[model samples]
Target chain A: MSLIDSISRPRAVRLPRIDGLIQWIVPLAIIAIWQLASVTGFVPTRVLPAPSDVVLSGWKLLLSGELVRNIWVSFWRASIGFLIGGSIGFAFGLANGLSQLSAKLTDTTLQMVRNVPHLALIPLVILWFGIDESAKLFLVALGVFFPIYLNTLHGIRTVDPQLIEMGRIYGMTDGELFRRVIFPGALPSIFVGIRFALGIMWLTLIVAETIAASSGLGYMAMQAREFMLIDVVVLSILIYALLGKLADSASRVLERLTLSWHPAFQKR
Target chain B: MQTALRTALPETELASQANFAPHARVVREERLAQTSGLPLTIRGLRKSFGDNEVLRGIDLHIPAGQFVAIVGKSGCGKSTLLRLIAGLDKIDAGSISFGQDVKPEDIRVMFQEPRLLPWARVLANVEVGLGRDRASQDADARAERALTEVGLADKRHQWPSVLSGGQKQRVALARALVSRPRVLALDEPLGALDALTRISMQRLLERVWRDQGFTAILVTHDVAEAVALADRVLVIEEGRIAHDVVVHAGRPRARGSVELAGLESSILSHLLSADDRT
Candidate 1:
């Protein structure tokens, strides 16, 4: 047989396909049990609002445009903070990775600073920026920067030296060497940084918004708790869950698109 | 023979003799005049790593379009010699001169590993050999032609991860040849292949070398492969040339013929004896 035919030929027996409904079975069953318990008074609705009540509250907020407006506000803050932090991190990574002088000058100081929890700086940030957007932006940016910077530096440091030698032998100038070999070799790690930073971005925003902000989903949830509006609080939590899942899914899609050439992603 | 005379002398004496060899210079110049491609000349090449001297005052001269193979035991510095010639490393002492027509960028080396960029398609990886000026429209066409030469034109669009070992090496060969280099250096390029695939690749390499007419220097430990592909085989021992044999057989020679086998056994014996001395 031909090589490609031998490799590409299917070996496993065909299995029946399920259209992913199997995944929803358990979550639906849990919702059904919860709804039954709430209606039959097995569990009091005051302590835990019914899923229907949470949905109704979400719909009310949506019609009033409060939910959308808060979401927009939170999204922009996260994006701005992420962009500023990610850019700085990427630049530092490239600098430290390519030059030993830069690494010697900055790497030790950065490592020492990164160990301190960024959230611990919240009080100081609030003191410095005074409850404005700057405080939340500073917190989120601090949280996201370390993962990106460290991973980018690691990725560049770990590229195969043999490949670099190959690039040099093939007549690539120093700039060409960086662009063709070093940058692409470092990209997979940078993507890892991006995904991790995105998670940290949301987490830091939530803390920052809750502590000081008057306008975001975290603030809404905090206000609902104060007023004993359990449905709206549950609704806010659900919104965060959905947004987190959406962001993670978006990262996965980006990974698939950029890393189609990678072997880890090629196995079906 | 000159090989016998050179091997009989100690390395220090040989290094001194090489400094005053007027006859050798005349021969080298005549060879250069007759050759169409780049000729390589190395004089008293020496390299050391910390305390372990890898190559000690080695000298070699290769005429253009000549396929020369260097065979030695592991750590005998054959690969190091090829690396030095390919300009991948600096020489501690010696002069290496190429023909006037040849630029430093006109030499390409292929390692045992294919070393294709995992993030690039086969064609794009081959086009990398064309250097940074890949914006020209002809870059793709030249890469496609090289792929066709290696019988991998159909596989150009596929990722390097999908290629088989032999196929990947062929892609590497395509990349090395895409620039139409005047000199090609192979550092055990087929060492990782299976026995059968290795034979086929040897044939393919021979065919490519014949058609391209580039000066080819191959560093291999396999004695049979050295005999099968090289016009002249130099056996390196303790960082110096111990035996130099010119194969009298012509191209398309039978693989299992007694003449080739005789040469292979003699080279193997020389290698084994060199091992015994160390």
Candidate 2:
């Protein structure tokens, strides 16, 4: 049959559990081996804590609610910065993508600005906004802005011309054309931008907090490092990893919700 | 509100008051036993993309409400001609003069790709053809009627991704017809479908055109489709009309009928003859 004739063809594979287990087996085995080595005293405890030791530290932190408090601070700051910077970037990116005059005027300036490291603005941000919440937020926002802007612009520009023409022919106004044809068409790329920006926001927050901060997971880690409380340092790192994973998983859920109707996500 | 604006509705509305009632001002014409509703006149319409000339000194007239198919090899400017008529492409010179009071919104087009918004349900895709304001105000009601017209009322909530190629095209057709455009232009809308699907879509298109009485201009390279769906087929050669054939076969045409096949063969022969001359 031709490819077109196979539109309704039945899927052949059915080993969904096998596919799931295939990914988990190696990671679980590695963790088990590490725990076994620690128990056997193959390595010194000072160098690497057993998984059980880390779990104990985690439990203590959790009981005191210190872990949650620190994490909450980091999460809130990242979210606020992401929302502000991302919105601004999204608007500018869309303008650049849609109009030739805007693209011509802004493309060069955007590229030049994007090349400058956002982290370098730390001292200046601190000087301008002080070593307060605003300074840390400004740093995080600057770090996130470029990825969202660049990806959103790319997404908008790549929307199919044929679809835009289809909208015009159907008596769609400019606003309707953008909403119905352009926005949904650019969604997959826009999600990519959101994901990238979220990752950067976390990274920037860590650096910004490590430099100067009274509360947050990054501040705790920096304080722990000074006293050589390696367990606390490891504990803080673990917390950061868990928090990042949670944020990423939430974003993935958002992506699936928005893009379930996309062709790429449809079941064969 | 003014008293006239708040006046009570009439008990029995006349046909003239209904939205679908054909306008009386339209002067219908006949060519080769087929009805032609209006004339699209273009005088010296010229366009060029930088150094490359796409349409050079083009002048043509298409009778209104007639099913006219434009056929040409790729880059022969057949699609360009359709775009210009639909007002999608701007002309560098001259002007496209429509029949009196011809509004820009009265033209609709169906493209080769289904081009349905992935986020939109099948019904919403159909409703996209309704102007943005209308689609926004009464989206659910308008989408329902359009989906019902396309025999897909049950699939109103179904995503476009789940649709088969033929069903997607059906949604696209529903979108084109929902707004009741006076002129419908199709650019190989059925070309991407399987042969069987294309045949069925051709019949569906013909039925809609006859029932709705909308003028259609189809741009295609398939001789069979040109003969089957069009009232008059214009074979464009070198950016100009070379042969214009009036297909005499009546509407509700069977896909593999001997009469339909004969007309298809005649067009094929004409295309070959033109090819030889070129």
Candidate 3:
């Protein structure tokens, strides 16, 4: 046999494959233990509901349309906030990246401002815009801006200078240099920024809704807590987790499509 | 061999003989007779980085379509000279003049690394050589033609990262030649390849230079490579031209031939003596 075959063939047999339904075994065991604890009165239901209780409450909310409506409201807020914040971040990042004068003028201030936590601005935002949609939108927008901006700037700065020099030597105009070399070279990092901003978008929405909003997943959970509906609260938390996972999966798909040329994305 | 040549010839005659071959003189004159490409004229060129002078005042003339190789030790400013000719860096003093046929856009430099855009496929990366005029009708056809010349037409759709080191350098060669540049400056373009690949690449480069008829200036530390491809091999020591040895061997020159090995040894001795003086 060839050396490569000799080296690789037995390695597959030594490591057991984790695939198919076997991957779900641990999650199922966790649910089974939780159910047993609830049924045996090892845990109080009022403080923490059983898996079945959470599912039943979720079904009830689904039938009532309250869960869907709240989810829609939360989704709308996150989308609008992200669109506004992400665009500004991208524009500022591009401007600073391309010109030293702009970077010198704006970078220090932006960095100083970025260090202030967006959540800490909750009281100030309420005072300025009141407990309205504007306040919530502003909070979410502020929260999502820094990651995208910082990452975009970092990406532009870290592009290989050799490539840029090659572009210039090949007779590329300034605009063409930016379009073909700078932008694509910075794209992978920009995508990282976008993914990080998406997570922050959800977190900021939760905080905004929990503090003052009338209709979102966070507000639904708070309302359930007031009524001592532990199962409904658990269901809301689960919905948030599901939404976060969906957003993350969508971003990964986009990354795969855009960065197919990257070696990291190539199939073995 | 040196003593035999010295004893058989006078000092002034030996100095002139070492500069270039009679056959190279014929080729240089024939190339100068053609009016298609530009000849390079450099005089009193100087460059410095902080306090260290990279290139002292240097002067050279290159006829159009002549393949010239510069051999130097590390940090001898051979690449600095190539960069100045390619207009990638400014000279501290003196002037470089190209013939009227040559425009700023007609010069291209191929770096040692392929420097291909990782996000682009092979064909698109070659297409980048067309610059901003990519929307022209014949740009795609020309890019394909250049790739085909480099023997990489079939790999047009592959990513650069998927290419081996030699293949990537071939792609880089295709990109450099895609624009049909009048002056092609190569900064140790094949330095990163293995021995076998380097030989193949040298052949490819010589073939391309012959086919394209551009003024080729290559910077390398390999003395054998300098003798193999270049019509004139310039040895740079202490940021100046120390020796100019012209290869008289004809095209499709034999590798490791007795004559070529003799020239290589002579150049090696000159380089070592120069190092000792420094």
- Highest-DockQ candidate: 3
> What lDDT would each prediction earn against the true structure?
0.84, 0.76, 0.84
DockQ of 3: 0.66
Q: Which stretches of candidate 2 lie over 4 Å from their true place?
A: A1-29, A63-65, A120-131, A266-268, B1-64, B92-98, B132-142, B254-266
Misplaced by over 4 Å in model 1 are A1-22, B1-35
TM-score of chain B of each: 0.88, 0.81, 0.90
RMSD of candidate 1 to true structure, Å:
5.4
Candidate achieving higher DockQ, 1 or 3: 3
Residue lDDT tens for model 2, A1-268: 1122223534476476786587679868977988899899996778877877878877888899988898889889999999989998898889999988998998899899889999988888888987789988888887788888898999898998888877776667788788878887787788888888888998999999998798888898888778876777778877777778777779777876777786545554
Report the C-alpha lDDT of model 2 over B1-278, residue by residue, as the tens digit: 11211131122212212321221112223432353344566767777778877776655566656777888778878898888888888888878876677765477878888888778788777777777446377777876787787788898889987889999989988887777777888999988999998888888888778766677899998988987788666666666555555565655666668876776676677667767987
DockQ-derived CAPRI band for the predicted complex in model 3? medium
Candidates 1 onward: DockQ, in order: 0.55, 0.49, 0.66
Q: List the residue pairs that clash in candidate 1.
A: none
Cα lDDT tens digits, model 3, B1-278, are: 23433443335444755544532333435543663456787878899999999998777777777788999999999999999998888889998888574655588889899999998999999988876567789988999999999999999999999999999999999988888888899999989999999999999998988777888999998999999998878778778776666677778889999988888887888889878987
TM-score of each: 0.90, 0.82, 0.91
- Residue-level lDDT tens digits of model 1 in A73-179: 99889999999999899999999999999999999999999999999998898889988888988888888899999999998999989889888877778998898
